[model samples]
Target: MTRPPAENQELYRFSTAERWVHRTSSTLMMVAIVTAAFLYLPMLAELVGRRRLLVTVHEWAGIALPAPLLAGIFFRSLRADLRRLNRFGPQDKGWAWRAMRYGTRAAGAAGKFNAGQKLYAALIAGATLVMMGTGLLMWFPHLSSLTWRTGATFVHDWLALLVGVLVIGHVRMAMKDPEARHGMRTGRVSPAWARREHRLWAEEEAEKQAEAESAEG
Candidate 1:
């Protein structure tokens, strides 16, 4: 069988809808984080002033954090990717073990999202839900007991710190991987990069392409 031209071989890693959803969610999360820092840090809060404004922005950002993902439910590509993120297979376990053992160097043959990416996605999702829930209680103190409100504040403060670290680490990793960053930015990646970073997913894509071509012929 004849292969397609090299120019036509770029693999689609993310769809437009997927990119938009990610961009939206990331922006909101960043806004929430920044505003939270201004609200919590005494020196920064004193310099920034406008406590009410910061609080409003932080609350709204938190409230709208899930909007993009909820809206993305209508997009088939995003839904498919969500399903992929939700599953854990044998390869995922192998990938996870290597990641734990060797840190970032353990990147090997894996699906579209390796175990680390999947774990990050899961953590972000859970953290978002927790943040929103705790945030809502704080925003409306009348909605909960004093004990509940105190507990929410404690959980919210600690989780915010954890998420800040996670986001910074995520950004640093992306900065080190230009091709992976390009895939997210442009929704496509060079076939060579895809093959090197996600061999199993690259092979699956090639198989699908071949099957489509055969049907056409």
Candidate 2:
């Protein structure tokens, strides 16, 4: 038996667990990426003179970074939503094209997610996978030949660069939508925010809640 959802409430969007993981993961990734960059840059390395600590930070960050995503899988709703984002359908592609037109021509309508968002998800996932792979190799260098370790080093560094660039764009987009940050920060967003940015998701949630209530009643 299910109870009816509060008719007009802006209940929590993210759970405490989700918020903890999101903030920790984001912070660790930022630290890892930035410290890693400094380690690679000759000028910064000369100034810091702490290559050992930077490498240590990078290695540990790689270990810490995947925890949130890994833990999030236990939350079925979040995992399912992630899969939806992972798969970009025909309409998604169309949205992308329309968004390009909107940006370039400034005359057309745009859909919920533009092409760039879809591409960002793909690239981010790719970079994360690469990072995990190379990081594992780096962490357990004794298991690999010298040649493999050398190759892994290059791959790891390059993928970190890609992740950094993609994440900056993600941050910029989030800043443009103030409510988006509030959603993660407070685990809730304004009703209008959901209706405007993700009406379909909101509608689906509403219908699901309605059906559950009907069954219980």
Candidate 3:
């Protein structure tokens, strides 16, 4: 079967650096989650039968979870994405309300990161910080009282479950949108897909394209 033309398929969405950060962070996050499961689940813990090894791996993976995001600061495109994730404008507020009422199919002029994506990012970042703090408390029990350690363990365990669920939902949504997944993988997407999913961003991209073409001419 003939593939689509290269030009038709090409719509630069993620940069190489952005994709790298995403994949690296995701891998580390998954590693931490899996190791955490082995440590937390009784049956899994017994089956694994290496508590020390699992604990060590989980600790290091949790520590490394934020490394990719910290490295992203050096990449202008990734920084831009961070900025986009931070902003919640009138359109974004509208999108949020509509999304709640009408679901993900709700139409709105979404920018590069929609309200849902922004919320998810913020939640994940917050959860990661909480996990890091609690994990550290649990790791170095001498740093705090027994009460504090117990509280930290409770928070860490619950937060891990919540993060796991959110990550699963995020993956499900991405799977439903092959173009979005392709953009992450290949650093590009279909322009048509962008226009449909992120109209405001699509318009801005179009404007940039037009300016470049005019300058070339």
Best by TM-score: 1
Candidate 2 at residue 125, lDDT?
Answer: 67
Q: Using lDDT as the measure, which candidate wins?
A: 1
- Candidate 2 worst ten-residue window by lDDT: 104-113
For residue 208, model 3's alpha carbon misses the true position, in angstroms, by 0.8
Worst 10 residues of 1 by lDDT: 1-10
What is each predicted model's overall lDDT from 0 to 1? Answer: 0.87, 0.71, 0.87
Model 3 CA RMSD to the hidden true structure, in angstroms: 4.1
- Per residue, candidate 2 scores C-alpha lDDT tens digits across 1-217 of 3333464676446776677777887898798878877888887778886678888888888777777878887886566556666666554545556655655123222233335665786787678778888888888989899999899989988888878888897898789887878888888866566656655455555677779677899
| Residue clash pairs of candidate 2 | 13-187, 96-115
Clashes of each: 0, 2, 0
Local error of candidate 3 at 175, Å?
A: 1.3
By TM-score, how accurate is candidate 3?
Answer: 0.92
